[model samples]
Target: MAPLEPTQPDCVWRNVAGAGKAECKIWQFPTRVSRCTDATNVTGFTWALTQTWQPPEGQVYKLNFDAAIFANLLASVVGVIIRNDRGQVMAALSLKGGVVQDSDEAEVVACWKALEFAIDAGFSDLIVEGDNATVMKSIASGQTDLSRLGNIYDDIHCLARGLRYMEFNSICRSANGVAHSLARYAKHLDEDIVWLEDSPPPALEALLAVSRLRLNEELEFTEL
Candidate 1:
């Protein structure tokens, strides 16, 4: 009998004076639907804590390398920890390599620097480790690099060839905590620094932590 008032913002009222009533119609808008897929779901894969820093065998040395990039400053730095089979920190290096285009390039630089360090130190048998699996795999394949990091990769390959034996392996970032921390520390440095038979105080805790791990491991074996 009476015209109904529009109760919603999107509804409009139509005059129906002849019928003695007003009609209100509301338009329905389409709602956006979002589909989110978990990375594990899409690839049918999951990550596990399977990696840890392990000392090399016998006289061989293990070098864990990592790189940190500062997008704001357009610079990158690399950190390397050289440890003997006993897990003793023989030497450490942190280098500020000016600038790099991406994290991949930064990692390449780190690997290259590690190789150079090994060469200078007269290390013949060494194992190079990094958190970047792709870079490690590429280097291990010994393939040509026609990409942006070709020069860096070529240098790495050249240095590696001088070694009696050099093995490149990738580990999870969690396993490379010491090198990762050192890389971050290098971000504020003006130049590269190298320590022999010692590590900077900032990395002392991590070194000690690894030493403790080694001790525990030795004790376990002795008990066995």
Candidate 2:
């Protein structure tokens, strides 16, 4: 079969309540895979939603962060999880904060908080991943941001200087489910929560789900 194409344009404009028009991009990925056998065997295919969390490089730690906006409550929640190269959880945090203007602000705040959490935990070399493309791009740009959230970006850049090594990565939401789940789980919390060498109950299921999907993908690739 031929490869799939995007159903929408690369960029679209949408009107926001107080922000006027905003530019956004939609990303699409294949949800199925097909494997064809040789003439001696019957052809078959299988379909499943696959997502995986990549491990960090040698001696480096991976930090995944996400934010959940609670518009009704006029607040936002941030979740951060750190893991070593062996995929062992080193630390995790779920924090609740004041209202954010939009998802973009909330995402930036989450990234800032995640960096702070990692620094406080004595992690010097790190790979930070988040599902917000815009926020990630801004952080990775290594240039001054003149936008409203420039201060936060400045703080993040300042924080990065203290680290021996740091990288910013943007991943799809499916791959960031653990942090997403933890952020959502913070809806019932009144203060910041932190766990060392462990994860909260809400994130355990998501962590396991991601592990299974990754294993299945590896097995399929090996078979192919």
Choose the strongest candidate by TM-score: 2
Report the lDDT of model 2 for residue 108. Answer: 94
State each model's C-alpha RMSD to the native: 22.7, 10.8
Q: Give the TM-scores of the predictions, in the order they appear.
A: 0.73, 0.78
The list of candidate 2 runs beyond 4 A from truth reads 1-51
Q: Name the TM-score of candidate 1.
A: 0.73
- Per-residue accuracy of model 2 over 66-159 as CA lDDT, tens digit each: 9988757789999999999878899999888778999999999999999999999998888788877677767765568999999999898788
Indicate which candidate wins on lDDT: 2
lDDT of model 2 at position 178: 87
Clashing pairs in 2: none
Kindly give the stretch of ten consecutive residues in candidate 1 with the minimal lDDT sum: 7-16
